[model samples]
Target: MRSLMLASLLTLSAAPALALAQPGKDCHLPGTEESLRCLRLAVPLDHHAPGAALSLHVTVAPALRESARRDPLFLLAGGPGEAGSDLVPLLNTTFRKVRATRDIVLIDQRGTGLSGKLDCKPGKNAETATEDELLAETRACIKGLNKRFNLYTTEQAARDIEVVRAALGYGRINVWGGSYGSRLAQAYSRLYPGSVRSLVLDGVAAPDQVVPAGAHDAQAALDALLKQCADDTVCAAAFPALRSEFDALAARLAKSPQSLTLPDPRTAETTKVEMTSMRFIGTVHNILYSQADSRRLPFLIHSAYQDRWQPFIARSNVSRDFSSEGGPAMPLHLAVVCAEDFPRLTPELLAEDTKGSFLGAPQIMRIGKMCETMSVPAVPYKEPAVIEAPVLLMSGALDPVTPPRRAEAARKYMKNAQHLIVKNGGHIVSPLGCMPRLLRTFLDQPGAPLKAECLNEIPAPTFQLNSAGPQP
Candidate 1:
C-alpha cells in the first residue's frame, strides 16, 4: 500500500528542459530521483564590505509542461541552517501539482549546503557531556570558522534571494517557506514586496517570538497528547495510568539518571548511554513532530515505566538520529540563533516560560552559554510589518514548536492573508492531506476563495493501543 502511494506521487511526467537565460548544468538533488538544473551564484561575503565572495548553490526543478508559468515557486528551508535544495523530495511529492505548471527554485542559504557551509564537528552527547565540555566544544567550533557569522543573518539571505531572482529573470515569484524558512519568506516579502506575487508560510516563527519560547509550547503539545490518549477508549483502557506513569518516570530520571546498554537502532551493536531526564523529555518532544510517531507515545511511556527500556531507547535513538540527518548544520544553526534569537532571551523570561514544564530551563540556558562565545551582536527584535502580497498561513494544532498561536499573531500584520489550522496536523502542514492541491489553487489565484473544506476531513491521529497497533 505504501509503495503504491509513493508510485502515484511520482507519476508526474518530466519534460525536456527549457533554455535558461543564465548558465546551469543538469544535476540531481540529494533527496529526489528526478534530474534538476544546478547553478552557482557568487555573492559578497558581507553585503556591506568589498572583499571575498562565496558562491550560493541553486537548484531549479523545471515544470513538467513545456511552457511553464513566468514566475516560479521559491522554497525556503527551515533550521535557519537547512539547505533549500534539500527539500526537493518534499516539493516533488507534496507540491507536485504546483510543479506541474510552474518551476520550483531552491537556493542553499549562504552558510548551508554546498554553499560556504560552516562545517563543524558534532557536539558530544547531551545526555553524557558536562556543561564545561559542551561549552568547550562550542568555543572550538567558533575558532575554526573562517567567515564572519553575523553576515549570514536572514536579512542578508533575503537580499541574496533577490539577486538570484533577477539573475534568473523571474518576475514576481511565489514563495513557500516552512519553519524558520517561513520567517525568511516573510523577511523576503518585506524587503522585496514588488518581487513576490504570493506567500505561503507553514509552521510560522513570528519575528517577535524568540526561539527559546518553545519550552512552553512543547509542554502544551505534550499535555494535548496526554489528554488525547485519555479521551480514546482503547488507549485509556490500555494505559489507564499513562499521565502518572510519565510524571513518575520523569521524576525518577531527574533524581538519578539511568545508564543502560542497548543495541544501536541502525547497527544493532551494543552501546551504553546515560538517559538523563532532559534527554528523555527532549526525545519525546522530538517524536511529537510526527503524528505517526506520536501515536506510540502511550505505549512507549508505559513500557518504560515497567522498566522495559529497550523499546524507548531504540525508538528514541532512531527518532533523534533520523531528524538530524541532513538537518541544520550545527555551526550555522548556532550562528543564527546566537546572533538573532539568543540575545533576546533573558533568565527571567526563560524561568517564567518554563515554569512547571517538563522541558525545563536547562536547554535554553545551554544555548545561552554557547551564545556567550559568539562575536556577532544580537539583531534587535522587531514586529514584522504588514505585507501587501497575498499570503496563506498554515499551522498544525499540535505543533510543539510553532503552534497555531504563532500563525494567529502573524496574521494580524498581514493586509491580505488567510490562516488555516489543521486539527489533526502537527508541524509543517503544507505537505499534509489536501494541502498540496490547496497550494496549487492558492498559487494560481491567491485572492480567490480556497477550496479548503478537504482539510476538515483529515481524521485525528489514532493511538497505539498495543504492539499490534490501533484496534481495527
Candidate 2:
C-alpha cells in the first residue's frame, strides 16, 4: 500500500513505437517475485491516423487452475499517467484469491511503463520549482516529445484498450480501475460495452468531475483529519494545541519560506530544501492518502511547530521522491489533463474550488499555464449515459481526492452497480482490510451481497503521540 502511494508520485517515460513482438513468454516484473508472461503489441499513436505506432507492454498473471474463467480481469491504473504494469505487485497481493480462477491482465497504457513512455527531464528541484520554472520545463518537455501531445487523450487510450483486448484474444474482461483510471474505465465501457464483463472502480473519478476541483475535496479531507484528532482522547491529550500549531506553522511558512539543510530521507546525505507554506501543505495532502502516514500527522505537526524540522523534512523528502520513483508520467499526465480536464476549469470555478483550501489554486494555475504551451485541443465534456454492465464502486470515506460522494455521483450513470464506502479508509480502499476478499467475491458473483460487515471491525488508526508510538 505504501508502494502504491509512493508510485503515485513517480513519473513515466516513452520511446518511439516498435514493431509488435511474438507471443508472450516467461517474464519477471520488477519489485515482485512472481513469474509472469509478457507481450508487446504495436498500437497506433493516433488511432484515427494509423501512420505511426507505439508498442504497449502487457503482462499476464495466469490463473492457478488450468480450467480458468474465459473472461480475464484487466487492471487499469490511475494518474491518467500511471503504467498499469507498475501495479503488478499490489495487484498480485490484493487479488491473490481472484487469480485462482481468472487470469489478471496488466497493460502499460500507451505512454507509460515499458510502452512508449513520455519522459520529461525534471527541473533541478521539482519540489520547490517556481510556477514560471515549472511551466518553462513543461514547454521544453512538450517541444522534445517525438509524438503529438494531443494524441494521448483518454478516448484514444480507451481505443488502445480495445486493441489490446482483441490481440489478447479475450472476448470480455472484468476491469479494476483506480483514481483517474476509474474515469478511463468509464470511457472504455462506454466505447466497448460488449467487451466488458464487469467493472470495479476504486476511488471513483466520475466522467463529469473537474480535475482542478480536487482542491475542495482535499480541504474537506484535511478538515476531517483535524476533527478526528480533536475527537480522539489520546490525540487531544497528546497534542492539545495541534490545530493552532498547524495554523501557526502554515502562517509562519507562508510569510517566510524556510531554507534548511537536512539529511535526505533516502540517502542520508546532506540536502537542502526550500520549504514554503504550499510545499508544507502539499506534503500533508500526500500524507493524508495513507492511514499510516495520517496517524503520524499530529506528531509531525507538533514537532515542526516546536522548530524541530528534521522529521518533517525527512518525511517530505520521502514523499517527494516516492512520487518521482515510479509515479506518473508527467508528459502523459499533461497530455491527458490538457486535453480532457483543463477545458472544464475556468478561473471563476478554480477560485471557488480552492477557497479556504490550504493548497490554493496554484496547481490548477500551473497546469493551466503548461496546457497553454502544449496546445492540445480540449476534448469536449459529455455527461456519460447509463452503463448496463454490473459495476462495483468502492471509495474511502476519508480519501483526500476521490471522496465517497464521487462514487455516488458515478453510481448515478450505472444501471447495475453497488457502492461500498470504507469507514476508516483513505485514498484507494480496494487493498484495505477485508477489501481484497470482498473484491474477489464481487468478481466471482457480481450480484451477490458483499459480506462487508467485517469492515466495521477495522479500527481507526491510532494517532502517534510520541516516539514510543501511540499510548497503550
Candidate 3:
C-alpha cells in the first residue's frame, strides 16, 4: 500500500508541461522575454527499464545573431547536485562573447532545480545529530526516494543531457563544466564522443580520483596562502609569525575548543557558537576555494590566535549560508559520491591517501558512514576518459579542491586537449583575471592556438593584514 502511494505521488508530481517546445524551434525562454527557449525533457526514471518518468528542465539562450552556429554550448554546474540551469544568466553574461554567435544551453541535471529534487532535510538539530541518527535519516530518505534513488548517477545524467541535445535538434554540442560539473562533462564526452564539438573543464576533478581524497591538495592550498603572506613585505611585516600563529591556533583549538558569544551580522544579536578544531579546519578549507576569501585567512588566523573569535565567527557565518532556496540536494550528493567514489575507498587506501595531511581521515569517514546503506545501480567508471574533442582544461594554481595536478592527470589521457593554469587563481579559473576573453577565444576557434599572455598579468590580490585598515 505504501509503495502504491509513493508510485502515485511520483506520477502526480511529474505534471504535464503547459507547452512543450518542439525540437529545432526558437521561442521566448519560459518566464522571461529573453530570446531563449525552455522545455521539459521526459527521461526514464531508470534508463534500462523505462517505466516511470522524471522531467529534466532544459533552457536554451539563443545567439544574438541570426547567423549562429547550430552546435550549442552546454553549461554543466558543479556540486554533483547544483542545477545547471540556475547558472544560465551568469553564463549568458560571462560567455557573452560566445552568446553573440552560439546558443547557450542549460540542463538542470536529474536531482536538482525544476526537476524532481531528492532533498533530505537537515533540521536545526542537524549539527548535533549522532552518526546513527544521520544514517537513519539517510536510510529513510533512500526508502522515500525508492527506485528514484537509482536514477541520480552522473552516468545517467550524462545520458540525460544527450537526450535533451537530440530533442533540441543539435547535432553536436560544446560543454563548459566547473568542478564536479567538469566530471559530468568528461563523462558525457566519454559516453557519447560523437556528440561533442569542444570541451571546457574548469577545476578539473578527474575520473579515478576519489572524492574528499582532496585533503592533501586542500592542505597544500592553505600552505600556499601562508607562503604568499610570507613572500609579501607588507603582509609579512604586519603578521611576522603568521605561520607559527596558525600552527599554535590549530594546536590550541585541538586541545581545548573555545566557546564564544559572537554577533550575528544578519540580526545583530549575540549567539553562542562553539569553535572546535574540526569546525575551524573545515572553515579554513572552505575559505581556500576562492582567492578573494583566502586573502583574509592570515588576518582571521592571527585574530583567532590572539583569542578574538568574533572575526572568525563573523567570516564563517558569511560562508555557511545554508539557505534552502538554492542548495545542492544533500541526498543526491551522497548518492553520486557513494555510488561512484566511495566504493573505491577502503581503510588502507584512505589511510594512505590522508597520510601527513592536516585534514586526516574524519572527513572521508563521515561520507563513508552516510553511504553504508546506499546501493549503486551501475558499475563505476574505472579509467580516464579518452576525449578527442578540442578540450581546453583550466585550473587555478591555488585551488584547494580540484588542484592543477588533477588537470595534469586528465591531460595525460586526453588526445587533443590543452591545459591552462591560472597562476595564483583559485578553484574556478575562467572568471578570474583575463581568462573570460581567453575562454571566448578558445570557444570561438577551439583548434586555434590560445593567446593566454593576459593571464600572466593577473597577480594575486594583496593579503588582508588588518581588519581595521587596508594594506600599506
Quantify all predictions' global Cα lDDT against the true fold: 0.79, 0.80, 0.76
Give lDDT tens digits, candidate 3, residues 111-223. 88777776766545344333355467667766676655666888888888877766565678899999999999999999899999999999998777787677788889988
lDDT of 2: 0.80
Model 1 over residues 34-137: C-alpha lDDT tens digits?
A: 67888776666776673667788888888888777877899999987789877878866897999888988898998898887776544546333543565686
Clashing pairs in 1: none
Candidate 2 lDDT over 253-329, as tens digits, reads 87888887767666677877677766788789889988667888899999988877877876776645213645678
> What would the TM-score be for candidate 1 when compared with the true structure?
0.90
Candidate 2 regions exceeding 4 Å error are 1-21, 121-138, 263-271, 321-323, 467-472
- Give the number of the best model, judged by TM-score: 2
Model 2: lDDT of residue 193? 95
Sort order, lDDT high to low: 2, 1, 3
Which of 1 and 3 is the better model by lDDT?
1
TM-score of each: 0.90, 0.91, 0.87
The window of 10 residues in a row where model 3 has the poorest summed lDDT is 1-10
